[model samples]
Target: MTKPLDLKHVALSDLHISLLNMRHKPKTTKGRSNEPILDDILPSIRERGIRQPLLVRPEPTKDNKNAYGIIAGRRRYFCLQAIVSEGGEVGGVPVCIMNADDDAQAIEASIIENMARLAPTPMEQHTAFDKLSKKGKTIAEIASVFGITTRMVKQRLALGQLIPVLKQAYTDSEIDNETIFALTMATKKQQKDWFDLFSTDEYTPTGEQLKAWLSGGGCITVEKALFPMEDYKGTILTDLFGEHDQFADIEKFWSAQNAAISVQADEYKKDGWRDVFVGDIGRHFPRYDYAQRTKEQGGNVYVQIGDNGDVHFHEGFMPKEEAKRIDAILHKKPDADSNASNRPEMSGPLLEYMSLHRHSIARAHLLKHPKIALRLTVAHMLTSSGNWKVERDYQRTSKESTDLSLTNSRAEQELATERQAICELLEYRCEHFQLYQRYSSPFNIEDVFGRLINMDDNSVMRIMTFCMCETLKNESGAVEAVAVLTGAKFEEYWVPDDGFFDLLRDKSVLNLMVKDIAGKSTAEYALTDTAKSQKQIILNRIAGQGVENPSPNWRPKWASFPSQSYRGKGSVF
Candidate 1:
């Protein structure tokens, strides 16, 4: 009933062409032009005489008895048909016969041949790829078969998901890559919401703007919220990889969180803090004008409440006017301490009482001329001069020549590193400027002067955070507050090596810190030895060497000296 299929049965004869099989593929027709492409193809084909063979498959009896479907080379089939119709001198057209069982197999062969040789239209590729995917081909396998990347395959599949109208625009090259990526996240309803604007307007958002617009006000993660979990009256949506979960109802969460924060601030105010400032939404903490004041000044404390229930307490800072009033009180000479000449009474608070008067007078003058004070402070910090200089002063015992070049190299390296770190943090870019330039250069002048004048409230606050972190002496509370608020942890980045430990001259402080991290037994043991031996033992513990039982799960915690530690009970300001 059926003839055996054989590859060697190829021949050179044209039977009646099956119109029934060919009708389904009007898109894969001969050419784009209205006129027949046969006009241009005929002369060359006449000389060449169909060097390549047509691929045809045997069709059943019902459509046209003894007919064959043209799987490929439709142009050649048409050319030979034209010659036959015109009664021209043409011999039999060569063809490779295929015994394809059905129309789907025939259609697949035609698609594969075309896709292999020519670039298909977006819709054509979409149709083909969708079929392959639906037939259970993995993205990698499809990419391998089509000689494309997995990313390209994914993009094409994403493009295929677009609605018919948008897909048609993409086919006509109306939309760009960024718009496609942005639109990929938009649902049909979301697209319809902006359909009028998309269809009519000449202007359309493409990159980050489009993404932001599609994403709404964005998301708040669990770590950044200030309110307790019990107070959150909203749901959360998880990321695809389950790495993070974001608040689904962002507005609801913020409303509850802000109310809680306001109550907390009020509680702080009622507890007798001079002043309190709450951070605004999507904004940084505010900086006090007179942030550098003495302990007696009763500095204003700042509390920042994050959306995810993170509370950062910044202590020991105050506004300028409040600092001035407190400075006045501290400078008021204490009625001569009636028993000042008495030996035992003179030993303790009375000595501090008299010393405070002299320091306060100097501080009053410095506060009056803040500009000069800031310049002098900058000088001290930069050159390690005055009280800021910490390098041990030893007599020059030998005639080792002072290599000024080496000194300059070290200074340049430190300055360059600081400059790069600041620029990276601020995302500030300036052309034709060296970050390590000397003060004589115009760039350096602009950096120091222009930055002071040009800083906005937000920029000023950010700079204040950096300055407070670096220059606020003996105020570890403020440093920890800034670190908590900004997510900048010193221990996370810095290594605790011998050079760092060498600066800790206070043996008591060193022993306390060692106990905090390495436990009481390790500290007690270190305290029994000399300070130098204690320092070595602590360094060994940090490096995880030479210690028999190292502290398990040890992480460095920088000390923050509480204000109460420096104040005596019942002491008057």
Candidate 2:
């Protein structure tokens, strides 16, 4: 039933090149084609001829006997078929006789022959390398054959180094190549989260654009969004709430706030284009939630911008087991500051944050929405404006770090710190609320700072000083002085040496002042609760304490409040 001939000529229609074989070809005909690119060789081949002979070998037919298998020269085979189909005299085409070693060795010989012509594209080279690697070829051997360095070979190999899950994403049209490359380059989870949040859409994105999104976060999208400036109406709210008698007095929201605050999760979430929502304040914390989604990039999440401009880096999600290890380290802090220990360095606000996250490539496989590594612990305060989109991203500046540390608190000093914090907090007063034409936050953190500006530590101390004066008028000289000023005479009350008098000075107004924290002897001047709350952050971060607790409470220093617009036919919720 089968022909036993070494060669046979049927019509071009009778012979079809095997697509599977062509795809698996050791040599890509498109590349390494000494025959010239089609655009260049179109004229010549049309005029002259296919100088090289096509390679083929005899094979046993499935039905019975002898036939031929293409050892190589797939292009020549096609060329001959085309010519003969057109009724050209192609009956006597020259062909190469070849022998086989092993299947892989045979493929290598075929690949080598093509490489002698011209080297292929990186992709082609990559494929060939993979085949050779499977065939037990070394990088050195492949490089030598292709006349390339091993580093080049390795870089190409790196392209295929994506996680299996990510590779599946690429296959399923969930992600692209450049994004994979960006993920490859990411050193932290936050960076990875940026892409994951941005890439979460149904459409397929080009690899190049995905890479741009992964590297720059919202930079590309922001550029596009900003272009339609006419569409973006920024109504700056001057001061919608007037410095009123009732609202200001009854609600302390206007008098207390810090400057830049942040909200993230224990697990990293995908956040790209999102809206900021602000919730009520005094139901404990009427606050705004800053949320984002990353769709284009994935892998790690890292955030670093420290006191004294020192930059730290935090990695992506951590498993529950790892988080426990971190917790164990936090229990035995040496100093009160909680900022100075290396053991606790794995968690909290530090130079290297690798453990706060709760998700991982391995973990993502089991969970749809795991706990994020960091989320701001604020009462829902996500104003429309608070929903800040991914604006842009940059590499952490390593040089910005100032190598300083901090310490913890003792009982008396702790009391004093808390008092000072409270006193300072009370100092903030609304001098006047500028009437605004509109309401609603135009910028991200305008309202939080607006309140912070009115709070002067000294100003609050003066108020407390007056209040104390009236409370202690009947107490006579020293006791009265200690109750009012908390100066050197009053230091005897609550300060280290002032233990006996500390009771009389217990609620003194002056203890909470920032000026009180100046002395090294915290024993002599206990920090007020308000003082500890306010400066505890700044001092622990920038001032650098000697406290031994490595894991400190991550009191996010970025203070920003969202404002709602009431002028646009809406009630101020």
Candidate 3:
């Protein structure tokens, strides 16, 4: 059945070349081994006249009168045709005739010779495979003939199905294989949209970022969804790989689920909870801080609803005094005895001892820095000068008096201008006052003074130490202590404003103010309420409203509330 080749009779012979008889060759540019022109082989063929002989087999009756299908060395045939077209000297191509019985054998021989020279590009290979498949070859049959895995063939076929633009991009090296794999998971519309973004936008996401964008960001997997699937009100969709299911309408699912949690929170209130505070959807109450209260203390319950329809029921958390009351009741202890135990034992003596030791160390440290102490002494001496009295008088006078009190007006304007210049030198912006304090650790005093003069660290530290020496009213006898240290009235310079009220959002600080300034009963009431309500009440008390005989001149000495203190291993002094 099979015809054998006469290898010994293969001889050099002349034959005309034509494109029509190369029917087995693919028409696509991707299928051709040397498309366009073989710039490298053309000149050499022009000089040496065709060195390698073209492998050919007798064509079927349907082919041209030439009656030969090229199996190998198509370059030799093309080169001779090129020389003829350019009106240069040309001759027939040498031939190695194969006695093949069918087109498959000739095509296989061509593929083997081409592969032995240099493997085709992936696109080219896929195109060839696709052409074979079109000619009624099975995937296994094609893989067997080509010496490639069936899986590889299938993968190439899938790549062959990619949109034309993506194929071009792959060939151009614009996108890698991983990105192409991700694009395969996308729908045609999604692929077009991504291509538009990639081509036109300045920021193009690739790899994982592109994958996340393609899969809706809010999409939740079944494992991550805390609520039971039976309770989920909306539909769910699965991924392309059948790996996971995601919520179809995350917002709708959360709405239904959070409503259920609200009912649960209300039921908790009916079950004798002191109060129930449910967090808004997408908010989680920090458990470490809010879980400090116990059940018997009449502590409130906090219910939180998460994005994935998860519900968290945190119960029995309340203020300090309420917790103490429950602790006393549970232990069957007397209230007075419990209150006495709650009070710090010998706190005043312990405080005094610590203060004495701390002050002694500080003084010894300051002694090492005499330049700093001298600056503080100078600031103290200047505090008693007539300039301060004149400055205060100028600041207090009405603007209406400025036309008449020319001397005082001139003094105040000069002083204000100088102070603003100093603040600017420190890179301070009043609008960003909060950020100034937040990033205070990165601020250097030497950097501030260096802008104005060639000041050393010693001079900068001296000026800073002098400015920092102020008597803040934090203790019971703080008023007397301030009067002795600064010789200034507490109510003379400060007043309430938006900034001051904003800082009172911290519940601990607001409650302490209510206890000390608005009496014990107001502090107790404010402690049990939300921080927002406590802040409002504190603001009202500051403005001398609702409370009996409120002190309008009760401004604290510090410009802002002190940040939470942290003492590190190194000495700050």
Candidate 4:
């Protein structure tokens, strides 16, 4: 037997969309279909004075007390929101509050209620199933909940693997089911290339043609082989539609080709070449970037492998810089005035010893005068003189979603705003300036100096601080030191999103996060659960869903200023 949900009336202002809602999409996801139409529902609700009650749970975080997160009836909530926006007088809307602790139950109720009202789109279904899957629900269990076949559930899950653009394209009805399904087989690079072609007026393959394109234009024919055909140990694939025979195994073909390349490299080495460098497959060797050089002048052999299995060797070539250096040495115009040898009196070790001691004395003296040190630091950033070649940190990440997450983060946005303000203050025309752009236009030194001279001391300090922040190296000891000194709070600037959760794979770390948010007892109970289950528990607690007391503004240890590992084994700081 189950207890009934408590029925109540909640004000529209107190309700918000929940993270658990199946229809809830992150703002980061662009080109998504518009929200459900409220026109039809608004008219009916306005006339009849409301009908069905919205299903909601207690707001997940303590920051919003007395508020509720709508798990079901999102469209109705939106309709009510619209009505209020239009300055319509509305009373407390009817609501049914579910147990906030039971995330799985809340999710199930949301899905069931949505299904009862209207069929969700395939992408929406995928989003729901993906959440369920992350909550430790098996494929069979999810299928059972939705009353669909396991195969259908799996098909929905596969949609999660598609890139955001492809997903958006499918949602926009620009591409059909067959085209999308075929694209699933394509690699990220291939999908990106295909999408680039599709976005233009170029001929983009579709459906069966896409499948053929993914198969490297219907297999690697023997005539396309860079190595001897007899050297390949794999069976040859014969195409009935074409006259030429193809290689059955792409891997095997590459192996023979690579072996042949190695042999050629060795031959070059034996033929008095300085060095033989083999670039990775798909890498292009730019001949125009290099200068032809004789073997005696430290020329090297460069082997480039094309994507289509073609190989080309660039012989007797060196970098333009190296060529110039060699030319300078060979075409020397000696100074006839004196015969003094171009040699230093001090040995290398002696010079290094003296330099280190001198540097130590200067550093010790500089450490005593904090104000002087600050001025020197500012000077280094402003002029970029001596060894101070200040450059912005790249903040590189392999995952596209993670990269996007950082780009769209509140912290990044705040920095951009600050940069724009600074640019305006400096009297620069930077209407379209991006703070992190690789090749931003250079500021005129005279114009900048003239402006800075007129600014107040505090204003100059702010500019200096921003410049230091921009050039600060990421993942360095300086970052940890500064974080500790400043008491930097990451939670104020960052929140967990799909990108953060997707990158988490360690079970131990996930369990630790569970303990941090849900408590030791809950963590112990879920110790043997799947990584996905632990992750959901963490998210639920963060949202203030199922816990008695939720940690507001909760952040993982790794996201902390001086990041720490769960086991204290791999402290990145």
Best by lDDT: 4
Q: What lDDT score is found at residue 446 in candidate 3?
A: 41
Candidate 3 TM-score over all chains jointly: 0.34
What lDDT score goes with residue 153 in model 2?
Answer: 68
TM-score of 4: 0.40
- Listed in order, each prediction's TM-score against the native is 0.36, 0.28, 0.34, 0.40
Candidate number of the best TM-score: 4
Q: For residues 1-573, what per-residue lDDT tens digits would candidate 1 score against the true structure?
A: 545433322323535443322222444323443222555456657667786676677764565555666676666666776776777666766666766555444545565554432335545565666666776778897776655567666666766656766665665567765566556556676565645567875666654455445545454556666678778877664322223455656677778777877887787678766667766554545542434332344555567655344566565567767766866887878757676764565767889998899899988988897655554443343334435532211222232223322223443355446556655544443222132222221122223444444445554445444433344443345545555666654443445543445455777766766676667976774564445645655554554443456553444444221112212342121
lDDT of each: 0.54, 0.37, 0.56, 0.75
**Residue range 1-573, candidate 2, lDDT tens digits:** 523324434332323232212224334332443232233233344456655555555444565344445555555556665556667655444554445334555455555544433233344455556767777878888666544567766655554555545544654455544455444433345344654565676553344344333333211221212123243333211111111111111112111111111233222343541222222332221111211112231223333332111222232223345445655786755676657665643445543334324435545653553221111101012122334321111122333211110112243344345445443453321112111102332222344334433545454344334333323333245443463454332212221211222222323332332233333343222333333233432243222332333223222111101112313333222
Q: Which portions of model 1 miss their true places by more than 4 Å?
A: 1-51, 54-56, 59-94, 97-99, 102-112, 136-140, 149-151, 217-573
Residue-pair clashes per candidate: 12, 118, 0, 3
Q: Which residue segments of model 2 deviate by more than 4 Å?
A: 1-47, 57-66, 113-119, 158-180, 183-573
